[model samples]
Target chain A: MGLEHRAKWRINIYAWLLLLPSLIFLVLFTFYPVLQTVILSFYQADLGSPEPFFNGGDNYRIMLEDDVFWKVLTNNLWFALGTVPTSIALGLAMALFANKALRGKGFVRTAYFYPTVVPMIAVANIWLFIYTPEYGALSHVMEWFGHGGMNWLGDRTNVMFAMIFMVIWKEAGYFMIFYLAGLQNISKELYESASMDGAKPWTVFRRVTFPLLMPTTMFVLIIAFTNSFKLVDHLVIMTKGGPDNASNLLLYYIYETAFSFWDQGMASALTVVMVVILLLVAAIQFFGLDKKIHYN
Target chain B: MRTVVKGLFSVLMSMALITGCSSGNAPATGSQAGAGAGSEAAAGSGAGKASGEKTELTFFYPVAVGGPLTKIVDGMAEEFNKANPDIAVKPVYTGSYQDTTTKIQAAVQGKTPPDVAVMLSTELYTMLDMDAILPLDDFIAKDGGSEYVNDFYPGFMANSQVDGKTYSIPFQRSTIVLYYNKEAFKEVGLDPEKPPQNWDELVEYATKLKKDGRWGVEIPTSGFPYWMFQSFALQNGKNLMTEDGKKVFFDTPENVEALQLWVDLAKKHQVMPEGVIEWATVPSDFLEGKTAMMYHTTGNLTNVKNNAKFDFGVAFLPAKKTFGSPTGGGNFYMFKGIDEKKQEAAWKFIRFMTEPERAAQWSIDTGYVATRKSAYETESMKEYVKTFPVAAVARDQLAYGHAELSTHNNGKVTKALNDSLQAVITGQAEPAAALKKAQEEADKILAPFNK
Candidate 1:
């Protein structure tokens, strides 16, 4: 009995030893920064003050009145709303069409998945040349179409929409793969079973496919929404929140505040707010996910 | 079970191994001064050998836009290393002026501050305020180059010194100069030699020079307006800030008058094109013969020289009430915690770079101006910098230079100026209202430091 007890203790000790490296990484890379950020958010830090002094949330208060902060936040929300649903719906449609017996089906699948591999910053560079007010491919096309040139990224009103359009173009392909996987996982017998009961194609899809794909849809939505919040890399290079802060997004604004202004305190506060937003969004997604997703 | 045990054992071994490696790689201690055992160990090659051990030092420097400077520094370092064989200077190019400052701050706080750093001369004060930089007076005296150091123009040296302590030595110096298209001058039939002297003549000639696809004068209002403001204030007999650096004096009559000319050039006269904020490509524009003239740093002269398809000449920026041209340059600061030996090495590099002959060669190579008075007489410096009555006027105007008065809060000030400039150009606000609003926004930011 003592030997068995000693063996149990040995197993427990081994488990802890195995996890020790990972635990260290979590503390050093993740928790340490989260702790640092929390401490930083309360102070006013710059090149002058290497270590910040306690400013007692003045950074947070200043953020409230900051018009650029408000602009960036609204721009982020606009980006998320604009890109997510459009990409998801497009992904689902493409997945459904590809799932059916269609000609050149394999080629279509590869073609639909191509944009996923091209990086956002690379795509932005291509898009930048394309949208140039003077020497752009788009401008040339517009001239061919008997319309004058347009400033796609240069126009304040059009910049967000332009960025959204590019994002949707890039993300739809990536999201479709998940839908395809989900579609493949759905029970085929159920579809035949519905058909035998004289159910219409629309009716069968509405009743069967919709219910089954809920899990995948939720996963895609969660990933896509979070991605939109985090991914504003194109803006950093393409626009730099310029044409008068028109296309600015939250994460880019955080970077600008920290690096450009040397205001680490404000940047950290912005980061905290972003984290809270992401947490709430993720929580909602997770809660909803449990309602529909089932294990085999 | 054997496989699982093997995996578990491997994981344990790896954890121990990695931790040992990482701990060993942490920021080295006392290696800078060669005092302690740890320091000697870090000096790496050999304590047993006859001479001294090789020391490793990091230089935190800004990467230029798309970063050619890093490559240049790296190339120079490789050459320097080959020549010396004992000393190694590792240059890390960390983004722009702003990003470099942030990085230096982080390094300092982390207690692993860089041995040497290239800093924007304007923000040298921030480091000085924290006593992050070492005073070079002792270094100069130790070198017995007291007279040699004094050979630099007193006016040029003022920007590097604060309260009798010289914290930085100018790495590259440039003052704003007027660049004109010779072809445009000829086309307008205005004698390129006799450029505009004051606001009234500037407007008149700019109007005459204006034609289709050619702006008379161009100013990049967004990125840094202080240069433009400095030119204006120097002419108008005023400074942007108080000497003590406590308060901003924008929205003053001198500034208003200066900004009014900017507005008149853009909005009222329509000589400068509309909706053009950054003169990012003004050099290109002038090179391509799109704009007749631009006011920019002497640093841009090389690019103009390299790319200009037509003859161009450098002139002093047109003055108002007096000749004020702000110094546009950067400095090298020894970061705090850089120990005595490395500090000595850093000064060696600075002195080598700033020696009048080196100063002339580098200035000619990079189109930087010779800050040292002795370098002015060098043949290379004289020949490379194309002569003009305007350059002389610009040199005379150097007496009025106030260093760029931007703290870390410079971004806020930049924004205010950008916003006001945009308003005036876009006809969103008239010059007075726009400047007033700018002053208000600027004051709001300045109030914190004021308190």
Candidate 2:
């Protein structure tokens, strides 16, 4: 018994040794900066006040009053609502289509995934040209339908929609890869049994394919949710949150506050708010929704 | 007992790793300076700085205009190094004016600012607020007092100083000008030699020039709408801000009328695009014949000259009441924290880079207005301008040029105005309402400085 306990302890030590590198990195990079940001949120530091001073909740108060902040937050929500579910659905649909026996399957997969391979900044630049008013690719296409002269990125009403569509085009393929993996993981017997029972393709997908892919869907949901908030590189290249902050996102707002405006305290506060939002979302997905997900 | 000892060892090892990671991260702070030193070493190789005794300086500049200006800047640095063996200058090309200011702010915060930088002239108040830049009055006095200071065009110098203290030296400076495609003008039955001279003529000319698949004129309203709007405001009646940089007059009737005319150019007259036109794309549009005439900086003169397959004419921006433009572009500024030796070396480098002959060459090469009045008198400048008379349009228009919109809390203030201008241009809001909202926003932002 004594020897067994010692062996278990030795195993524990080895496990800790294996975890040391990542643990140290997490503590150093993530936790320390988060703690610093939390502390900074309570201060008043800006270009005007380079030397920081404690000003309790003033930054938060200003953020609450800032119309731009509210506009960016609303834009982010609309962006997420516009991109997430549609991309996931499109991803699943593409995965389902590709899973079947089809000619040029490799070509189809490559074409779909090509956008994901390109960098976001490069994608934004390409799309920026495609959205130019008269001579842009989209305008030319619209001209075929007698609907020419649409400013994709310049108009407030269209900028958000345009950005959402581009993000979906870039992201759906990435999510498709996971769904394809999940689709393959299900045994062939389940489909055969469903066919033997005379279940239609739609019913089989409803009852068999989707329920078993819950684990992958859950993981993808978390990733997509966080990404909706985190993906801001396109804003830098395309809009700079222009047309009166119509397409600005939370992270970009934080970046502008910290760097461009030189309002570090306000940036820290914005970051904290963003972190809380992401944490709440992740918690909901992990704890509340995970219980209902079916795992094989 | 053995198990406990193993557990303690594991804990100690993890602690060691945590401390190691932190120590490893310490160099990240110095990485910017290290990168600068590394690039200087690479650039200094041609100068043969084997002595290791030279005072090295990192100079940051932005390329706001088109062309291979970076190569020219690097060549200037190399020439400076060869002329002065004791100093090594590394020119780091920061992005546009916005990106350059952001980088400068980051460097200053990190306590490792470049020795010299060419930031936007409108960044004067922002730099002053941060106390990051040094006053150049001392250096100017040592050089030639008011004589050296007065040599730079007063129009460009308008935003370079405040409270009787000169803070920046004008280098790459520009004013707004009208760029018209001569072929398009002639095709539209207008004289190629005569561009629009006033508001009424502008609308008439633009209407005549407008056709299918072509805009008559495009004043870009994307990147620096506030600067372009300032030109309109100045032409109408008043400058955007006070001379002291303490207050702004954005909601005046003249400014509102200016914005109204801009909106009307698109909505009522249907001569220009209805939505925001990008700053970078406007020049390309002109080159592509998508627009017959464009309001753009004279900095694009070299670019248009090189790329235009058809003849083009450069003239003053059409006046509302009088011909006016806001002087725009970067000014050379020295940082405050450097040692006296480095300061003098930086000052020497600035003077070298801004010498009359070099200024004339720069203007000829890059199409930035030669900042010094004496530069135009130089033989090279005279010869170049004689052949290319359009290159001197911006210089002649400097007489009517005023300072760009710069005030306390400049970024936020300018952003408020930019948003309002964009709103008005996009037809999302009326000119009067937007300007009033912008004025209120600016007042709130500048309230702290007012006290």
Candidate 3:
């Protein structure tokens, strides 16, 4: 018994030793900062104030009443609603197309995945020129179609839609790779059996392929939802949440509050709200949807 | 049970290791580039101690205008270091004015601020509130007292002082001016030699100049709408903020009329675009001949001069009640908490950078209006002005210039006004209602400072 216990003890030490490196980083960068942000949310700290003071729930109360906060939050939801399902469906369709035995399959896959390789900031700058009024590439395209002089970014009504379209173009290709991987994971025998039973391609896709891809879809949904809240680099380069905050999103608002306004307490509170939202979304996906997912 | 206990012990051991590593790593990467520069300067000073004592100073500056301004700044620093071998100045480009301010805030919080920086003049109140910058009165007194301070243009100096104590010295300063395509003016049947001189003429010229493929005029309303709006207010017979920086006059009747005229340029006259005109793109639009006239900083003179394929002219913005613009740009400020030796070196660096000949060269090199009045008297400035007569238009407009809108809590307050202007310009809100809302917001923001 003593020898057995010693062996187990050695294994435990080895396990902890291996984890220590990443564990320290995770604790320092992630856990500690999260805790600090939570604590800061309860304080009143602004650049004007000499020192930070406890303000209880004042930050939260102010956030509730803050018009910009609500506008950005609503914008984020609309952005997610617009981008998530469409990108996922588009991703799946592209994956199916690429999966078929077609000529130049590699070229098609590379072309589909090209945008995902570019950094977001560079992408935003490229799109900035593309969307610029009067002389932009998009304006020239619009002129060809008799819709010249459409202000893609300057008009408040169209700014959000423009941002949503750009985000979808950048993200759909990324989600396609995951769906492609999931498609390859499904047993070939299942498809063969279905085809042998005289199943049409559309019917086979509906009844066989999509159900097997549920796990990837759920994972992609969570990623897309979180990403909609996380991405704000484009805002810095593009519209800057302009035209009366039409294209503003949650993370960008928090950044402006913290860095630009120097309202640490308010920014922390906003961050807490964002974290809670992301957590709730992830929980619903992992718990509520996991039970219904058909795991192969 | 024994395995669990051993695991807990190992966890504590790993925690200790983590803390040890982090503490060891903190100084190396704590404050990003600032910390790295600090250690390098420290090493230089240590090495210099064995020879003659040397003070290494880090100077942070932002490039708001387009050009190879960073190269100019670096070259100046190298010249300074060569001229005064005992002091070495390292110039760090910290991006735009906003990014530089943010970086300084972070550095100050980390207790590793650069020895000197050139931040926006409007940041005076914000820096004072943070207690991060030093008042330059002592340096000025030691140099030449009023003689030194008075050499700077009074209009540009308006934002550099508070309660008779100077905090910053003007460097790259500018005023809003009308940049017009002379070729377009000729094509529209207006005399190329004559630009609009009043609001009525402005509308008439713009209406005549508007074509299907081009706008008549574009005043950028996206990035710094409040700055552009301040010109309108000043032209309409009011400045946006008081001298003390405690009160704002955003909702006055004059201001309302100014905003209404701005809206009418697009809505009623159909001369300008209807929505927000991006600040960075307006100059490009003018260069492309898509806009006949543009209201932009005179600092862009060099850019427009280099890029324009057609003849262009610079003039004072068309007056409403009077010709006016708010002086804009960065000023040299020494950070607080540095040693006396470093402070003296930094003061020398500032003086060297702003000498009349250097200022003239800078103006000629990059189109910023020379801050020192005597800079215009330099032979180089005279020859350049004779060759390119429009280069002096911004300097001539100083008599009508005022301070940009700067107040306590400047960021939020400015944003309030900017949002209101954008809303009105975008036709989402009425001018009266939006300006009134902006005034209330600014009042609330300024209330604490008033106390």
Candidate 4:
């Protein structure tokens, strides 16, 4: 018994030793920053000051009172709501088409996956010129129709939708790959089984294909949700949160606060709010939505 | 069970390898810096082996716009290094001014600030508060006092001095100017040589120039909206902030009138775009003849001159009460915590870079205003100005230029005004209401500094 106990202890030590590097990284990069953000959120940390002044909950209070902050938060929420489902649905449609026996299917798949390979900054620059008033591609098309062109990026009412449309164009292709994989995994026999049951095509898809793709849909939904919060690179190039904070997002606002304004404390508080919201969302998705997703 | 254990072990090992690969790279670069210092010492000794070693100073500068600026800056640094063998200068082109400030501020916080940086002149109060910069006064006094400092244009100098101490040296300074398409002016039946001199003439000229496909004028309201708006307020006989950089008068009646005029140029006069105009696209718009006239920095003269197909003219911005524009652009600041040797090396580099000949060369090359009055007197500058003639408009406008809008917590304060200005420009809020809201925000941000 004593010899067995000593051997088990040795194995346990070896296992922990193997994990040491990953543990160190997790602590240093992830956990430490999250802890620091929480702590710093409680203080007033001007970059110029020697030490941060402890001002409990003041940063939070300021965030609550900041109209731009609220505007940006709602904008982010709307952005997520606007982009996620549309992209996912488009992804499903693309996957469905691509999975069918069609000519040039290989070329179509490559085309669907092309945007994911391009960098976001390059996309933004291209889209910026493409949205130029009266001379851009959209404007030229509108001119062909004998209608006046709208200021796609400059007008407050249209800017968010414009951004959402671009994001969908960029993202739907990426999400399509996941759905394609999910589709491939669903056995062709299931479709034949549905057909033999005297089901129409719509009924076959609704009862058979949809349930099998729930896991992919859930995964892509989480991705699209997080991306809406994280993707502000296009904002930097296209708008810089202009036209009266119409298209600003939480992450971009935090960047402006921390880097541009050098107000780290308020930025950290904003970060904490973002992190908490993400956590709650992820928790709800993983726990609540996980049960609904069919697992083979 | 054995295969599962083996797979888990392999996965853990790969994870460890990946994390190790990442975290291990940082210290290697740190040690590389150590090695670099050693090599630098050896190279310094290897140069002469008799006189003391050369001092290498790191400079952080930003290029706000995309162009040949990085190459020009690198060429200037190489030239300076050639002229002064004792000082080895390294110029690092950081991104825009905002990025440069963030880099410098981070370096300061990390206790590894650069020897010198070209920051925005409006960063005076921020730099002072950071306690990150050395006062140029001491260096000037040690190098035989105010004569050298006084040679710079006083309008540019207005932003360099605070509390009777100078903290920055002017470089790449600019003032707003009007760029009008001569062909468009002729087509509109206006004299090509004459530009608008006052607000009434501006509106009249714009009205005459307005047609189906083109706007008569465009003032960019996206990037640096506050900077452009300052030109308006100053023309309307109001300054944004006090000389002390404390109090701002955003809600003053004159400022309201100024903003009202800007709004009316779009709504009431119907000669410009209705919503916000983008900064980066405005130059192209001007060059493409989408707009007949534009208000932009003089720094864009070279860009327009290169791309414009038709004849163009540059003139001073039209004034209302008295002709005025705000001095804009970057200034040289030496960081604190560097040794005197590096500091002196930085000063030498600044002197070498800002000599009358070089300053004039920079102006002729980049379209930035020459910092010193003597630069305008230099033979190269005089020749260039005579040849182009429009090149001198910004230089001649110096008499009417004041300091750019700078104050305590300047970024947020300017942002307050920018948001409000944009709000008004976008027709979301009225001029008076927007300015008043901006005033309240600026007051709140400035409260701590005042206390």
Per-candidate TM equals 0.79, 0.91, 0.92, 0.91
* lDDT winner between candidates 1 and 3: 3
In model 3, state the lDDT of residue B111: 56
Please give the range of 10 consecutive residues that has the lowest summed lDDT in model 1 chain A: A146-155
Top candidate on TM-score is 3
- Angstrom error of the Cα, residue B426, model 3: value is 1.4
The complex in candidate 3 yields a DockQ of 0.41
**Candidate 3 lDDT, A115-138, residue by residue in tens:** 889989899989988889889999
lDDT of each residue in B1-451, candidate 3, tens digit only? 0121122223333444555555533432223345676766875786776578678999999998777899999999999999999998989999999889877876665556789999999999988988888888888888868998898888999999898889999999989999999999999789999999999999999999999989999999886699999998999998999888999999899998889999999989999988988887889899999999999999889889888999999999999899999999999999876766688899999999999999999999989999988999999999999999998899999989899899888888988898888889888999999999999999988898888
Q: Give the Cα error of residue A79 in candidate 2, in Å.
A: 0.3
Give iRMSD, candidate 3. Answer: 10.9
lDDT of 1 by residue, A90-174 (tens): 9999999988847999999899998888877788778876765434577678887765345566456667888999899999999
Q: Local error of candidate 2 at B186, Å?
A: 2.3
Instruction: Report the candidate with higher DockQ, 1 versus 2.
Output: 2
After superposing candidate 4, which stretches have Cα over 4 Å from the reference?
A1-15, A47-50, B1-51
**For candidate 2, lDDT tens digit of each residue in A236-262?**
778888887878888888877765676
Native contact fraction of candidate 2? Answer: 0.31
Per residue, candidate 1 scores C-alpha lDDT tens digits across B147-237 of 8667765545666776566777776767787888877888889997787877788899899898866779887643455667666876787
Docking class of 1: incorrect
TM-score, prediction 2: 0.91
Worst 10 residues of 4 chain A by lDDT: A28-37
